[model samples]
Target: MNYEGAVYRPPSEARSLIIQVTIGCSHNKCTFCYMYKNKQFRVRKIEDIKNDLDESRIQYREVKRIFLADGDALALKTDKLKEILEYIKLIFPECERVGIYTSPQNILRKSVDDLVLLSSLGLGIAYLGLESGSDTVLENVKKGVTSSDMIEAGKKVVKAGIKLSIMVISGLGGRELWKKHAVESARILNEIKPNYIGLLTLLVEPETEMFKQIQAGEFQLLKAKEVLLETKELLNRLTVDGCTFRSNHASNYLNLAGELNEDKERLLKQIDDALSWKFGTKDEMYRRL
Candidate 1:
């Protein structure tokens, strides 16, 4: 496949075949993100995309999954996305699912009918970054959307029969707003009730605005115990039934995974163990973005 600067997909899509349908994030203004800073945003040519698909058919014999990359594949026009989906069905009849990353703006741009059409055409799941559900944190980080906007967008995706995977940063509120961040994030998750909820801890990278803020002593990162306490509070507030929750990302201090409501107590107990120093967190030296 023809790849661009940097391609990113959900960790669950680790084994899937990836193709860049877009060059970079269309709204690459999140202060915490530096993933696509070096690349310009643009939809790839339809012909080039098709060529890559054709080459992939020749390369892999039994492709089961495909992940559209870089950042916002759903930002493409409805007709254009339909064409790509149709071609994928024709070329890889056995492919079971196709997933993509979508921002709130991308979701808002597409009509419900457009989303339904895409879902019907084998677009199985969409990964959305909620970042933080606290409006203060969101605005501070320039997430470009409110908590309510994300909730509405997530509901739309679910209404269209597309599985939604929502991600939130654990320490996004920093030390000052940690409590509000935790509670509001849980509130948003309870409202959306997404199929998947991924909790990733914050890791400020070099060259990003967040890194500069940390350097200037403007933002205070949460300590390991504080992160656990925040997560426990968030989990305690979460009431979404049947929602799968995961916080096992390499960036997370603790690895937590289970279905909500049922395993809530177990997860909370694990957090307690970590807080009491009975269990350990991922070493800070090993954490990554």
Candidate 2:
């Protein structure tokens, strides 16, 4: 078994594997992203992906899960995605589940039946980027999906009985719009009540729109402490039913995990205690990080 296209593995993968099917983000206009900027989007030839799947099965016979990648695998047409999913099952019969990074535009275009068919084919998870729920911030970031659109997309996934993990950027709106960012994000999360709410704090890389904004003095990058405050504000307003919350990314100042409804207050207090610390120095915060 030979793979024609290049393969990239995430540092965090131990039991998980990423199978690249596309080259770049289909909708790569997000201001905060620089992940796949240098490449153009293209769906790999089906035979190439099938070969990779067969090779992966041979190399990692004990693999339990797989994540399709190269920005957004869901961007592939439904029948094409279905073929890939079925090929995965055929090669990795013991594989328990499969996940993919999905764009809202792609998800919106998918009918519930298509999602359900995919789910029944062993597609267990969909990681959606719901960066900021404030329509203004979404527009500014070029997210290409409104808060309402995101909510609808989320509901459809839930209705299809598939697990939905929505990722939100903590400091996306920066200082000027921090309040709205947190409040609207919380409101959207509550309405959607996705199975998992994952958070990634903003990290500026050169050549990204966000970087240009910062250089032009239009966007204010928050200090680590300020990020913690914004996280607290979000946690304060988030009142969803029973979604699990996670902020364990290395980019985040603090990592927290717990059930949303039961552990919301506890997590908020953790943030408050960290922020109120008169540890009296920027050095202290740096030391903690």
Candidate 3:
């Protein structure tokens, strides 16, 4: 299959067939994100996408899932998205689900009826980055949406019967506002009650605004212990039921996964056990590695 630029999909969609329905992220201005900085955002043409699907149909014997790439494929018009989903149904009858990354703006702009329509057409799950629930932190990081907007967008997807996987960064607010960040993020998550919660620790890579901020002393990234504390606070405040929580990303200092409400106590204990280890201070232990 033909491809353009770097492709990214949710870690859960690693085994799924990936097609670039759009190139780059439509909103590529988040200060902490460098994912789509190298490319311009543009929607791929319908026929070109169909051709790629046609090619993939011959190359693979069976495909259980397909993920639309890159960034926000939900930015496409409803009719166009419906067409693509319809074609996917026509060509890959055995495919179980289709997933895409979506921005809060895209979700908010599309009415629930539109999302419901898309869901009926095979758009199964959506990945949204709710970097922080603190509007101040969201503004500081240039995430381009308010916490309320993020909550509304997340709920919109859920109300439409689409599986929502929301990602929240552990240290997004830095040391200054970490507590506010944790509490507000948990509150927002409880309000939305997404099907999945993905916890990621912030990684300030080169060539991003965040790196410049750190150089200029405008941001203070959290230490390992602080991150664990923030995670615990966020976890303690969460009351959502039947949601899968995962923090297994490579960027995370501690990888965790479990169902919420039921596994909350066990997960907290796991963090406490790590905290109680007599080897050394949490920061020092991590630093020695």
Candidate 4:
């Protein structure tokens, strides 16, 4: 099989399949993201995408799940996305689900009909980078979409009957607007009440605008303890119904998992226990690894 030119799959996708149908992120303007900067954003031709699927099926037939990449496969036109989905179904008839990363800006542009069509074509889940629900925070980070826009867009996606996984970054507003970031983000999540809420701790990758702010001492990054406090505050404010929460990344100093309705109190207790123990010590941070 020709593995050449295919991007490496992230370890996070060990249980899923990776299908590259796009070259890079459609909106690479988010300040904290460095994932797609090395390449320009463009959708691959349907034939090329089908070829990649053919190659994958030749090696591992009948996979149950897949993740379309690079960065926001939904950015493709609805017809193209549907064509790829049809090819996927033809190739892997046993495939049960498929997901893709999506930018709120891209989603906002899509009509409800387009979203419903994609959902009906087996685009089961979407990973959305709803970094912050504070308009100020979003603009400060150049997220390219406002809090209201995200809410409206998220509502449409949900209305289309697709499972939504919304992600927010802790410490995104750094220290200046930490409270706003936490509160506004929680409010948005509460409104959307997505199927899943994934929390990501911010990391300033080199060459991004955020990294320059850090070097110039313009943005004060939150301490690990400070981030935890902000996370706890955000969690305290989130009152979503039946949402699953996860911060399953090495970047997070602490990991958590809970359902909104069933384990909210338990998750809060876990956070409180960790906090009361004076846990954000340097030792604790390293030990979490």
Candidate topping TM-score: 3
lDDT of 1 by residue, 1-289 (tens): 6487878889999999998899999999988899999989999999999999999999999999999988888899999999999999999999999999999999999999999999999999999999888999999999999998998899999999999999999988999999999999999999999999999999889979999999999999987788889999999999999889999998888899999889999999988876766434456423421
Ranking by TM-score: 3, 1, 4, 2
Which residues of candidate 4, in runs, are more than 4 Å off? 1-12, 279-284
> What's model 4's lDDT at 164?
90
Each candidate structure's TM-score, on Cα atoms with residue i matched to residue i, is 0.96, 0.94, 0.97, 0.94
User: 3 or 4: which has the higher lDDT?
Assistant: 3
CA lDDT, candidate 4, residue 160? 94
Q: For candidate 2, give the lDDT.
A: 0.84
Clashing pairs in 4: none
Residue-wise lDDT of candidate 2 within 1-289, one digit each (tens)? 4333454433233458778888788998988888878878899899888877877777875878988887778899999999998988887888888888888888889999999999999999888888999999999899888999998988888888888888899889898888899999999888888999988889989979889999999999877788888888898888886788999887787878889889988898888878877544556775764
Best prediction by lDDT: 3
User: How far out, in Å, is residue 133 in model 1?
Assistant: 0.8
Model 3 off-target regions past 4 Å? 278-289
lDDT of 2 at 219: 92
